[model samples]
Target: MKPIEITDIDVSYGAKKILEAITFHADAGEILGIVGPNGSGKTTLLKAMTRIVARDNGEIRLDDRDLDSLGHRELARRVAVVPQDISIGFDYSVRDVVMMGRHPYIGRFASETARDVEICDHAMHLANVAALAGASVHDISGGERQRVLIARALAQEPTILLLDEATSNLDVSHQVEILNIIRDLAGEITVVSVFHDLNLAAYYCDRLLLLKDRKVYAAGAPGAVLTRENIREIFGMEMLVKPHPLTGKPYVLPVYMHQSSAGANRRVHVVCGGGTGSDILHLLHAAGFTVTCGVLNVLDTDYGTAMHLGLPCVAEPPFHGITPESLSGLRKCLESADAVIVTAMPIGKGNLDNLRVLLDYPAKPVLFYARDHSTRMEDCTGGEAGAVLANLEARGALRVEGAEELLARLSRDGSDRD
Candidate 1:
């Protein structure tokens, strides 16, 4: 397969520019993913490469040959695109639809040769649509139809395949199956797919190009392109980008606003560590509380969540015990907060100071998620942390059994203050 080079490409609808000074190249035998929010020209860019959308300026070249120089048939022989939407008004068998890809190879009046049939068969098998070959294209499910369309593209024998949000309508399982097939095909054919699922793109694509505001926002490996800051800038949404546990690829989890308005003017300070604080922090922020969290280690999961939400956090170095400076910072946060909540995380010497400081701030309304006291004390420092927690409870700290109850209590308290 040949590499695709797009240089200084500009596309405009009349006087309105859709893409400006766009430049990128998809390497041979690699999957290059294009991602951006709606109206960012992801589909427009794919259409430009296939000449479905004419570029007002710049050049698109496959290998060294210019796209404009190639005839329609010649371009179809080299580049095949699976459009975002496919409609079959007339009833056509899946096999018949797939055979259409051979038009470039077979002359206008010529019949399909044995080799053409074999190529179409192989394409169907590769796309896992061989069993559905006799079915009507309109009778099958959307996922099945999608595979059939991909089979048709494969049968085109193109050096480059362009997928314009092909998996957008697929369910999770179907999405995985389709993307896996594309990933495998990348070993031999160049693939350029536009994706809405950032996690899937990060996992499958060899490289990614993020488009924003009519230009390339960031382009590189997933780790370099899918940062929290980049998503916030391009999508105007809060997201947490972390490593996938199984693949070690970038995983994106969107932070949604669960509540529409601020429930109260009260501030809440949360004491948490390990990964325990993530849910509490999210709920507090979504509930419209001015939330602060501390003293999380710099690399902890909770710290990442806190940073993603733009919450002020007191952080210490990773793998280090909490220092006096961090404790002092926590105390200041407690002083300003109307209430404090702690998640159920195992307590160790490194963070036992969290419990100690909460005990000192007895005047503030303190809540402890003590759903499983034994589990929380499993890592207690010689039971010292457990004893401190017990002392805090005795000093009027409220204990909640679960997140639902905690949120309920918080909502009730916010209403009471109002």
Candidate 2:
């Protein structure tokens, strides 16, 4: 199988240009993903590869042969496309629909040969659609239809498979199943897909080409292409990029509107570490409270989440105990806050100073989340942490069962303050 090279391609509708100087190569046996905001010409670029949309200028070549020079049948034999929308006017059995992929090799007046039937059957099984072979396409679910279409493309036996949002209609399990199939076939058949779900693209694609304003914004591996800065610039939205726990690939989460009028004047300071503060910070920020967190290690997950949320944070260096300067900063935040929350997090010598700060701020309304304090103490610094927590409890600090109750208490406190 040879690569499909697109060079300096330009496509326009009358005077309106959709793509310009779009250059990239779909190497043999690699999955290249196209990702960008809507109207960035993802679909148009795919159309140019299959010659479905004429390029006003530039060349698209398949194995050094110009796509324009290849006859229809020859092109179809080498390239198979699964469009984003699949609309069938007539009700056809799944097997019959898959057989359509063998059209390039069949004569107009001839019927499918035994080998064609064999290929179709194998394709259906590979797509996990063998059970649906006898069912009418109109009677199946959207996800099942998507798999059926993929089977048809597989039956084509083309060197290159182009999918435009192929998994967009499927449920979570079906999406995973389809992507698993595509990932398995990637090294044997070149797969070029456009994906709206950045995480899925990052997981499955060998390389990514990001588009913006009808031009290449970035092109490289997923890590290089899908950065916090790049996504913000291209999509005009704030997103947090984290690694997938299982695959360790880049996963993106968009920041949604969570501001609340009820919490407009409330200020809360959180003393948490070891990832326990992340959910509390998120909840407070969403509820419209001015939230600040302090004395967290620089590399802690809580610090990272606070940074992503644009919250004020007082962080010390990684692997270091809290310093006097950081403690002073934390004290300032506590002085300005109307309430304080201490999440149930494992304490060590490095963060034991945080508990001491809570004990000192006995006059302020403090909510101690003690549900997991025992478990957290058992993991680290049990003696010192348990003693300090007892001191804070004796100093009139309120005890809350969990985050939900803490939120309710905070709401009541805010009302009382008002």
Task: Put down candidate 1 lDDT per residue, 116-155, tens digits, no spaces.
Answer: 9999999999999999999999899988999999999999
Each candidate: RMSD to true structure?
A: 3.2, 3.4
Q: Which candidate number has the best TM-score?
A: 1
Q: Show pairs that collide, candidate 2.
A: none
Model 1, position 44: C-alpha lDDT score: 94
| TM, every model | 0.87, 0.86
Error of 2 at 47 (Å): 1.8
Residue-level lDDT for 136 in candidate 1: 99
Give candidate 1 regions above 4 Å deviation. Answer: 258-265, 310-326, 348-350, 370-387, 401-418
